[model samples]
Target: MMSLYLLNTKNTYTVAALMEIAKELGKEDWDFSQNPCDGNPNWVTPTGNLSQSKNVVICTCAHNDSCHVVNITLMRQDLTGVLPPSLAKLPSIKVINLAFNYLNGTIPNEWASTKLEFISLSGNRLSGSIPTFLSNITTLGYLSLENNLFSGKVPAELGQLKNLYLL
Candidate 1:
Protein backbone atom coordinates (compact mmCIF):
# COMPACT_ATOMS: atom_id res chain seq x y z
CA MET A 1 0.00 0.00 0.00
CA MET A 2 3.01 2.25 -0.34
CA SER A 3 1.40 3.55 -3.49
CA LEU A 4 -1.71 4.29 -1.51
CA TYR A 5 0.15 6.06 1.28
CA LEU A 6 2.62 7.85 -0.99
CA LEU A 7 0.30 9.12 -3.66
CA ASN A 8 0.52 12.81 -2.88
CA THR A 9 1.63 11.61 0.57
CA LYS A 10 -1.76 10.39 1.67
CA ASN A 11 -0.16 9.15 4.87
CA THR A 12 0.13 12.78 5.94
CA TYR A 13 -3.56 12.84 6.72
CA THR A 14 -3.22 9.58 8.64
CA VAL A 15 -0.40 11.07 10.66
CA ALA A 16 -2.44 14.15 11.30
CA ALA A 17 -5.27 11.97 12.51
CA LEU A 18 -2.87 10.15 14.80
CA MET A 19 -1.60 13.44 16.16
CA GLU A 20 -5.09 14.64 16.83
CA ILE A 21 -5.91 11.38 18.56
CA ALA A 22 -2.74 11.50 20.60
CA LYS A 23 -3.40 15.06 21.63
CA GLU A 24 -6.92 14.21 22.68
CA LEU A 25 -5.67 11.22 24.65
CA GLY A 26 -3.05 13.35 26.41
CA LYS A 27 -0.36 11.17 24.88
CA GLU A 28 3.09 12.67 24.38
CA ASP A 29 6.49 11.73 22.93
CA TRP A 30 5.24 10.38 19.65
CA ASP A 31 7.80 11.42 17.04
CA PHE A 32 5.92 11.54 13.79
CA SER A 33 9.05 12.61 11.89
CA GLN A 34 9.86 8.94 11.34
CA ASN A 35 7.59 6.49 9.62
CA PRO A 36 5.23 5.06 12.22
CA CYS A 37 5.14 1.76 10.36
CA ASP A 38 8.87 1.29 10.85
CA GLY A 39 8.34 -0.31 14.29
CA ASN A 40 10.20 2.41 16.14
CA PRO A 41 9.90 2.50 19.92
CA ASN A 42 8.52 6.00 19.58
CA TRP A 43 5.59 4.57 17.70
CA VAL A 44 5.59 0.84 18.54
CA THR A 45 6.44 -0.72 21.80
CA PRO A 46 9.29 -3.14 21.32
CA THR A 47 8.36 -6.77 21.75
CA GLY A 48 9.38 -8.71 24.91
CA ASN A 49 9.88 -5.61 26.99
CA LEU A 50 8.13 -4.89 30.25
CA SER A 51 5.86 -2.55 28.34
CA GLN A 52 5.11 -5.03 25.63
CA SER A 53 1.48 -5.03 24.58
CA LYS A 54 0.83 -2.07 26.84
CA ASN A 55 1.19 0.62 24.20
CA VAL A 56 1.72 0.15 20.49
CA VAL A 57 0.63 0.83 16.96
CA ILE A 58 0.71 -2.39 15.02
CA CYS A 59 0.73 -2.18 11.25
CA THR A 60 0.70 -4.50 8.32
CA CYS A 61 2.82 -3.76 5.28
CA ALA A 62 1.80 -4.91 1.86
CA HIS A 63 4.18 -6.67 -0.53
CA ASN A 64 4.83 -3.30 -2.13
CA ASP A 65 5.76 -1.87 1.28
CA SER A 66 2.60 0.13 1.80
CA CYS A 67 1.80 -0.12 5.49
CA HIS A 68 -1.65 0.14 7.04
CA VAL A 69 -2.42 0.40 10.72
CA VAL A 70 -4.46 -2.46 12.18
CA ASN A 71 -4.31 -2.35 15.96
CA ILE A 72 -3.81 0.21 18.72
CA THR A 73 -3.20 -0.82 22.33
CA LEU A 74 -2.98 1.80 25.06
CA MET A 75 -3.62 -0.04 28.28
CA ARG A 76 -3.06 1.33 31.76
CA GLN A 77 -1.42 4.56 30.71
CA ASP A 78 -3.12 6.89 33.15
CA LEU A 79 -4.07 8.91 30.11
CA THR A 80 -6.72 11.61 30.38
CA GLY A 81 -9.13 13.00 27.74
CA VAL A 82 -12.20 12.08 25.80
CA LEU A 83 -12.46 9.54 23.03
CA PRO A 84 -11.51 11.40 19.87
CA PRO A 85 -13.55 11.11 16.71
CA SER A 86 -10.36 11.30 14.67
CA LEU A 87 -9.83 7.61 15.48
CA ALA A 88 -12.34 6.75 12.79
CA LYS A 89 -10.03 8.29 10.21
CA LEU A 90 -7.68 5.28 10.30
CA PRO A 91 -9.34 3.40 7.53
CA SER A 92 -7.55 0.14 8.28
CA ILE A 93 -7.81 0.12 12.05
CA LYS A 94 -9.55 -2.91 13.53
CA VAL A 95 -8.68 -3.35 17.20
CA ILE A 96 -8.42 -0.75 19.94
CA ASN A 97 -7.75 -1.19 23.65
CA LEU A 98 -7.81 1.96 25.72
CA ALA A 99 -8.66 0.35 29.01
CA PHE A 100 -7.62 1.75 32.39
CA ASN A 101 -7.37 5.35 31.32
CA TYR A 102 -9.08 8.49 32.58
CA LEU A 103 -10.99 9.15 29.37
CA ASN A 104 -14.53 10.44 29.63
CA GLY A 105 -17.34 10.75 27.09
CA THR A 106 -19.40 8.29 25.13
CA ILE A 107 -18.12 6.68 21.97
CA PRO A 108 -18.27 8.95 18.97
CA ASN A 109 -20.94 8.25 16.42
CA GLU A 110 -18.29 8.70 13.75
CA TRP A 111 -16.93 5.27 14.74
CA ALA A 112 -20.12 3.49 13.78
CA SER A 113 -18.80 2.88 10.29
CA THR A 114 -15.30 1.81 11.22
CA LYS A 115 -14.20 -1.78 10.64
CA LEU A 116 -13.22 -2.29 14.25
CA GLU A 117 -13.66 -5.88 15.40
CA PHE A 118 -12.38 -5.70 18.97
CA ILE A 119 -12.88 -2.74 21.28
CA SER A 120 -12.12 -2.31 24.96
CA LEU A 121 -13.14 0.95 26.62
CA SER A 122 -13.51 -0.66 30.00
CA GLY A 123 -12.16 0.95 33.17
CA ASN A 124 -12.71 4.59 32.27
CA ARG A 125 -14.99 7.43 33.25
CA LEU A 126 -17.23 7.23 30.19
CA SER A 127 -21.00 7.66 30.63
CA GLY A 128 -24.25 7.53 28.68
CA SER A 129 -26.14 4.61 27.18
CA ILE A 130 -24.02 2.45 24.93
CA PRO A 131 -24.70 3.46 21.39
CA THR A 132 -26.94 1.01 19.61
CA PHE A 133 -24.99 1.85 16.47
CA LEU A 134 -22.19 -0.35 17.73
CA SER A 135 -24.16 -3.21 16.25
CA ASN A 136 -23.70 -1.59 12.88
CA ILE A 137 -20.04 -2.50 12.94
CA THR A 138 -20.69 -5.97 11.62
CA THR A 139 -17.10 -6.98 12.11
CA LEU A 140 -17.23 -6.49 15.85
CA GLY A 141 -16.62 -9.68 17.81
CA TYR A 142 -15.24 -8.87 21.25
CA LEU A 143 -16.30 -5.88 23.30
CA SER A 144 -15.45 -4.85 26.84
CA LEU A 145 -17.57 -2.09 28.38
CA GLU A 146 -17.27 -2.95 32.04
CA ASN A 147 -16.01 -0.72 34.88
CA ASN A 148 -17.46 2.50 33.50
CA LEU A 149 -20.26 4.88 34.41
CA PHE A 150 -22.55 3.86 31.58
CA SER A 151 -26.26 3.30 32.30
CA GLY A 152 -29.15 1.68 30.42
CA LYS A 153 -29.96 -1.73 29.11
CA VAL A 154 -27.47 -3.30 26.77
CA PRO A 155 -28.85 -2.81 23.30
CA ALA A 156 -30.64 -5.85 21.95
CA GLU A 157 -29.18 -5.04 18.55
CA LEU A 158 -25.88 -6.32 19.85
CA GLY A 159 -27.40 -9.79 19.80
CA GLN A 160 -27.29 -9.53 16.04
CA LEU A 161 -23.52 -9.78 16.13
CA LYS A 162 -23.33 -13.47 15.30
CA ASN A 163 -19.57 -13.35 15.63
CA LEU A 164 -19.57 -11.76 19.04
CA TYR A 165 -18.15 -14.23 21.55
CA LEU A 166 -17.11 -11.93 24.38
CA LEU A 167 -18.63 -8.87 26.02
Candidate 2:
Protein backbone atom coordinates (compact mmCIF):
# COMPACT_ATOMS: atom_id res chain seq x y z
CA MET A 1 0.00 0.00 0.00
CA MET A 2 2.73 2.49 -0.82
CA SER A 3 1.59 5.85 -2.15
CA LEU A 4 3.89 8.34 -3.84
CA TYR A 5 3.75 10.74 -0.90
CA LEU A 6 4.26 7.97 1.61
CA LEU A 7 7.50 6.80 -0.01
CA ASN A 8 10.80 8.00 1.42
CA THR A 9 12.54 11.14 0.16
CA LYS A 10 14.86 9.09 -2.03
CA ASN A 11 11.87 7.32 -3.54
CA THR A 12 10.33 10.68 -4.37
CA TYR A 13 13.52 11.60 -6.17
CA THR A 14 13.32 8.31 -8.06
CA VAL A 15 9.80 9.21 -9.17
CA ALA A 16 11.04 12.47 -10.60
CA ALA A 17 13.84 10.61 -12.34
CA LEU A 18 11.34 8.22 -13.84
CA MET A 19 9.29 11.14 -15.11
CA GLU A 20 12.34 12.49 -16.85
CA ILE A 21 13.05 9.07 -18.31
CA ALA A 22 9.52 8.72 -19.63
CA LYS A 23 9.66 12.16 -21.19
CA GLU A 24 13.06 11.66 -22.78
CA LEU A 25 12.14 8.25 -24.17
CA GLY A 26 8.90 9.45 -25.77
CA LYS A 27 6.95 6.91 -23.76
CA GLU A 28 3.55 8.27 -24.74
CA ASP A 29 1.86 5.35 -23.06
CA TRP A 30 3.20 6.33 -19.67
CA ASP A 31 0.33 7.40 -17.46
CA PHE A 32 1.23 10.21 -15.14
CA SER A 33 -2.13 10.30 -13.38
CA GLN A 34 -1.67 6.94 -11.65
CA ASN A 35 0.71 5.96 -8.91
CA PRO A 36 3.73 4.45 -10.66
CA CYS A 37 3.71 1.41 -8.41
CA ASP A 38 0.04 0.62 -8.33
CA GLY A 39 -1.63 2.13 -11.37
CA ASN A 40 0.14 0.97 -14.52
CA PRO A 41 -0.65 -2.59 -15.40
CA ASN A 42 1.72 -2.51 -18.36
CA TRP A 43 4.46 -1.70 -15.93
CA VAL A 44 3.82 -5.01 -14.27
CA THR A 45 5.14 -8.38 -15.36
CA PRO A 46 3.22 -10.83 -17.50
CA THR A 47 3.01 -13.23 -14.56
CA GLY A 48 0.09 -11.10 -13.33
CA ASN A 49 1.62 -10.58 -9.94
CA LEU A 50 2.46 -7.23 -8.44
CA SER A 51 5.75 -8.27 -6.87
CA GLN A 52 7.03 -9.66 -10.15
CA SER A 53 6.43 -6.53 -12.17
CA LYS A 54 9.22 -5.90 -14.69
CA ASN A 55 8.82 -2.15 -15.01
CA VAL A 56 9.15 -1.08 -11.36
CA VAL A 57 9.53 -2.79 -8.06
CA ILE A 58 9.19 -1.24 -4.62
CA CYS A 59 10.99 -2.54 -1.57
CA THR A 60 10.04 -1.76 2.00
CA CYS A 61 12.43 -1.38 4.89
CA ALA A 62 10.50 -2.06 8.03
CA HIS A 63 13.43 -1.27 10.30
CA ASN A 64 13.50 2.29 8.98
CA ASP A 65 9.78 2.54 8.21
CA SER A 66 10.50 3.50 4.61
CA CYS A 67 9.91 2.34 1.06
CA HIS A 68 12.30 2.67 -1.86
CA VAL A 69 12.79 1.65 -5.46
CA VAL A 70 15.13 -1.29 -5.90
CA ASN A 71 14.94 -2.14 -9.61
CA ILE A 72 13.98 -0.56 -12.97
CA THR A 73 13.68 -2.43 -16.28
CA LEU A 74 12.74 -0.82 -19.60
CA MET A 75 13.98 -3.31 -22.17
CA ARG A 76 12.99 -3.12 -25.83
CA GLN A 77 10.57 -0.24 -25.29
CA ASP A 78 11.84 1.77 -28.26
CA LEU A 79 13.02 4.50 -25.90
CA THR A 80 15.32 7.31 -27.07
CA GLY A 81 17.32 10.03 -25.32
CA VAL A 82 20.38 10.51 -23.19
CA LEU A 83 20.62 8.64 -19.96
CA PRO A 84 19.58 11.09 -17.27
CA PRO A 85 21.81 11.78 -14.28
CA SER A 86 18.77 11.99 -12.05
CA LEU A 87 18.73 8.20 -12.03
CA ALA A 88 21.70 8.33 -9.70
CA LYS A 89 19.43 9.82 -7.03
CA LEU A 90 17.78 6.54 -6.18
CA PRO A 91 19.66 5.77 -3.02
CA SER A 92 18.43 2.22 -2.74
CA ILE A 93 18.52 1.15 -6.36
CA LYS A 94 20.37 -2.07 -7.04
CA VAL A 95 19.64 -2.84 -10.67
CA ILE A 96 19.08 -0.79 -13.85
CA ASN A 97 18.36 -2.26 -17.28
CA LEU A 98 17.65 -0.16 -20.35
CA ALA A 99 18.83 -2.50 -23.06
CA PHE A 100 17.56 -2.63 -26.65
CA ASN A 101 16.49 0.99 -26.86
CA TYR A 102 17.63 4.01 -28.79
CA LEU A 103 19.36 5.77 -25.90
CA ASN A 104 22.61 7.56 -26.57
CA GLY A 105 25.19 9.39 -24.47
CA THR A 106 28.02 8.64 -22.14
CA ILE A 107 26.97 6.86 -19.00
CA PRO A 108 26.50 9.55 -16.39
CA ASN A 109 29.48 9.99 -14.03
CA GLU A 110 27.11 10.72 -11.16
CA TRP A 111 26.22 7.03 -11.14
CA ALA A 112 29.67 6.11 -9.94
CA SER A 113 28.61 6.74 -6.34
CA THR A 114 25.52 4.57 -6.32
CA LYS A 115 25.08 1.12 -4.68
CA LEU A 116 24.06 -0.64 -7.86
CA GLU A 117 24.57 -4.37 -8.25
CA PHE A 118 23.63 -4.74 -11.90
CA ILE A 119 23.69 -2.36 -14.89
CA SER A 120 22.89 -3.12 -18.52
CA LEU A 121 22.82 -0.65 -21.42
CA SER A 122 23.43 -2.98 -24.31
CA GLY A 123 22.06 -2.54 -27.84
CA ASN A 124 21.90 1.24 -27.62
CA ARG A 125 23.67 4.15 -29.27
CA LEU A 126 25.69 5.23 -26.21
CA SER A 127 29.18 6.52 -26.87
CA GLY A 128 32.32 7.26 -24.81
CA SER A 129 34.71 5.02 -22.95
CA ILE A 130 33.37 3.19 -19.93
CA PRO A 131 33.67 5.22 -16.78
CA THR A 132 36.56 4.29 -14.49
CA PHE A 133 34.46 5.10 -11.44
CA LEU A 134 32.41 1.99 -12.15
CA SER A 135 35.20 -0.02 -10.57
CA ASN A 136 34.48 1.81 -7.33
CA ILE A 137 31.07 0.17 -7.00
CA THR A 138 31.90 -2.78 -4.76
CA THR A 139 28.42 -4.19 -5.14
CA LEU A 140 28.43 -4.27 -8.92
CA GLY A 141 28.42 -7.79 -10.30
CA TYR A 142 26.96 -7.52 -13.78
CA LEU A 143 27.67 -4.91 -16.48
CA SER A 144 26.79 -4.90 -20.17
CA LEU A 145 27.96 -2.38 -22.78
CA GLU A 146 28.07 -4.51 -25.88
CA ASN A 147 26.87 -3.31 -29.31
CA ASN A 148 27.37 0.35 -28.48
CA LEU A 149 29.65 3.10 -29.74
CA PHE A 150 32.14 3.11 -26.84
CA SER A 151 35.82 3.68 -27.58
CA GLY A 152 39.18 3.32 -25.75
CA LYS A 153 40.82 0.40 -24.03
CA VAL A 154 38.88 -1.40 -21.31
CA PRO A 155 40.00 0.09 -18.05
CA ALA A 156 42.33 -2.13 -16.09
CA GLU A 157 40.67 -0.51 -13.09
CA LEU A 158 37.61 -2.62 -13.82
CA GLY A 159 39.70 -5.54 -12.59
CA GLN A 160 39.40 -4.03 -9.13
CA LEU A 161 35.79 -5.10 -8.75
CA LYS A 162 36.04 -8.26 -6.65
CA ASN A 163 32.39 -9.15 -7.10
CA LEU A 164 32.14 -8.42 -10.78
CA TYR A 165 31.53 -11.62 -12.73
CA LEU A 166 30.41 -10.17 -16.04
CA LEU A 167 31.38 -7.29 -18.39
**Whole-model lDDT values for every prediction:** 0.84, 0.75
lDDT of 2: 0.75
Instruction: For model 2, give the 10-residue run with minimal summed lDDT.
Output: 1-10
Q: Work out the TM-score per prediction.
A: 0.90, 0.81
Alpha carbon lDDT at 56, candidate 2: 53
Off by over 4 Å in 1: 1-8, 51-53
Error of 1 at 46 (Å): 2.3
Give per-residue CA lDDT, model 1, range 1-167, as digits (tens).
11222312646677778888888888876676667787778777777888523778888877766667789888888888888788899999999999999999999998898999999999999999999999999999999999999999999999999889998
lDDT score, candidate 1: 0.84
**Tens digit of per-residue lDDT, candidate 2, span 84-112:** 67767778889888888889989988888
